[model samples]
Target: MDAHRKQRQAQHPSLTITDMYNVLEKLRSGEALSAKEQKTHEQGLVSILLQLHTELDAAVAAAYGWPANLPEEEILERLVALNKERAAEEARGLVRWLRPEYQNPQGTQQTEIGLSTKTKVAKATAKETLAWPKTLSEQAQAVQRALQLHERPATAEDLLYQFKPVAKPQQGQRLQQIDSLLQTLHGLGLLRKTELEQYVK
Candidate 1:
């Protein structure tokens, strides 16, 4: 039983409310999650469901003053309702964080960076053939650093800056190299440039 518990723990580490919210947010926005990220997200969802199931089961048992066992359908129905309530609560919280003050489209409002500009950049960046110059390990390191910053649609400079010794100087001759990398990412549709240069998710 201890071994079983350990195995379960390894497979299903507990997730916090924020972890579930992040997973849901990524899914809602149609963001692509790598296999590892997807696995973590699924584990988090399962953990939330299991917790809800236990709570509902206890509540029903207490209410009826009955045994631990309940009909599967009844349990499921209650769980569904609980999930809906949780979702609503989460949405309200998200709205508070996503209020208009923080809500800005990628450079769309600027006359200089209007639809045409976006389209041009997006088209250039949306090429499926373009690949990152970094190795898998290096790319993962860059992505990890980018995740630490509050910025969304992190600029090419921002990503390269995170690389430090691995990346060239920020200005002069290195500017063209940085631009080339960003353009490559944009062509590959990996990064979306938004208004105010914010990159989310």
Candidate 2:
């Protein structure tokens, strides 16, 4: 792991992984880092990591047959569309099992599960509502889309309502997830926070 980190660091000579970790440790422990430490953190690993992540995202988008430079709203929209398409395929008995050996077993035909009228209605409703994305990157993009649609600064609660109905039991967890994503988006400069603790793109 250290060697891999060093190789990545070598790709961006200005970034110092050690200094970044030191600064992060200080901040996480509620200790203030000096001006120099702060500067190192800003100019070091964080910037390099962001650049690397951008490249990775572009590559993944290309692999998905999507435009690499798509905006956050478009990315989330495309993802949602793809998800619905997959669900529709599954409804028609086309199950694309990732681990066929474990999921389908040998020589066993996959059975088509018939959907009831009520279940189909529920699914149609779900298709109209955006679900929380499973991956952190996509979740961040969803937050960005929410902010764009809001057209004004929005509190986390305001953004949460844009997604699919969260169960009462999961509301707290979902709120925390939104808060973390908000902080991450703010740190990446994809979002800005108002004095009132609202987020805007």
Candidate 3:
């Protein structure tokens, strides 16, 4: 604050508290000063006002028993402890952030679930998920299309092999779904399964 006030004094050599009050009174009474002097005068007033507000905020926080500063380690430890306690309370359906009147009647457990930073949305419903098809029939059609494009029967593992330029990537994790769809297609007489090989009809 002192440095700022000194800087302002250097900028406006004749600036003073008396000068500021007189200029403010003149402004209030609809009198105008040169634009450059008015800017300098306002800067001086604003610098003092900034310091005054800063000191007032510190005083108010002190009056309420708030510390001005805390060690970085202490802050981190407090945040971790707070998060742990909040998690425990939330698990017991004691959510405190939401209003009592506005709390979900079905349950807060579901509302609070999947809120952790590490939590995912089950991959399929991820926010960045594309419109890559997922229905039983759609997945079966995908397998059939892959087979017909190859123009030959393909083994279960071969069908699982992803062709490039395909909208959806390899169904590596979803081999079970792919297998199920193939079985359903075979059951519906849309596909022919001879040994481990599947043929599109």
Candidate 4:
């Protein structure tokens, strides 16, 4: 039993928060790990896995009104499975960041393409100006279509660009109308101002 304990201790090295942070920093910076760094990362990974397994066992035991008696090998196996799942979830979040519809921040009211960074004024305001619709049905349908086409927070300019074949109001009137719609949607929390002034869903 003493020999078995020693073997297990040798396999699972202790890790500190500093070690974990170092591994994360290296990963974020896209740096190639040295042999020592690689070993540290492996140790840190194993440490987290073991800690999670122990926590889970304790939680499960408490929930069932029993004391935990989880074995080390079982904890190690569960940790491996959980780590894979965590990696997959992170990859999915990265994919979302790359998608055009979600790539931009949702709350920006306008794009500040050439604005000086020193300017204190916001690129756009969230002020509401949309005129109430004469008929709820028409308004609802328009909103639904806009959402389907990924035109959420769609500016009048964007609408005009998208549906060029459709006749539209004069530029002044069109701008006013879009502002009104944007106000209504913003109030409903369907759209928000993204970075600078760009609006998105």
Q: Pick the candidate with the highest TM-score.
A: 2
Ten residues in sequence with the least summed lDDT for candidate 3: 120-129
- Selected candidate, larger lDDT, 2 vs 3: 2
> Mind giving the per-residue lDDT tens digits that candidate 3 earns over 4-42?
667767887877756655565566556777775477568
**Which regions of candidate 2 are displaced past 4 Å?**
1-128
lDDT of 4 by residue, 1-201 (tens): 223334434666464555656765677568888887678667656345444444444433322223366566866675577567556765775222222345545733333211123321223223322232344333432432343354355454554333223334455665554555554444444455555554554
Tens digit of per-residue lDDT, candidate 2, span 127-171: 244678776556655666666566679988887887888789999
Residues 88-175 of candidate 1 have per-residue lDDT tens digits of 7657752212222345434323111111222222222222223333432233223423433424466555554543344334354443
Model 3: residues with Cα > 4 Å off, grouped in runs:
1-132, 163-172
Supply every candidate's count of residue pairs whose N, Cα or C atoms clash at under 3 angstroms.
Answer: 16, 0, 0, 12
RMSD of each: 20.3, 17.1, 25.7, 23.2
TM-score of 4: 0.27
**How close is every model to the real structure, measured as TM-score?**
0.24, 0.39, 0.29, 0.27
Question: What lDDT score goes with residue 133 in model 4?
Answer: 39
| Candidate 3 C-alpha error for residue 186, in Å | 0.3
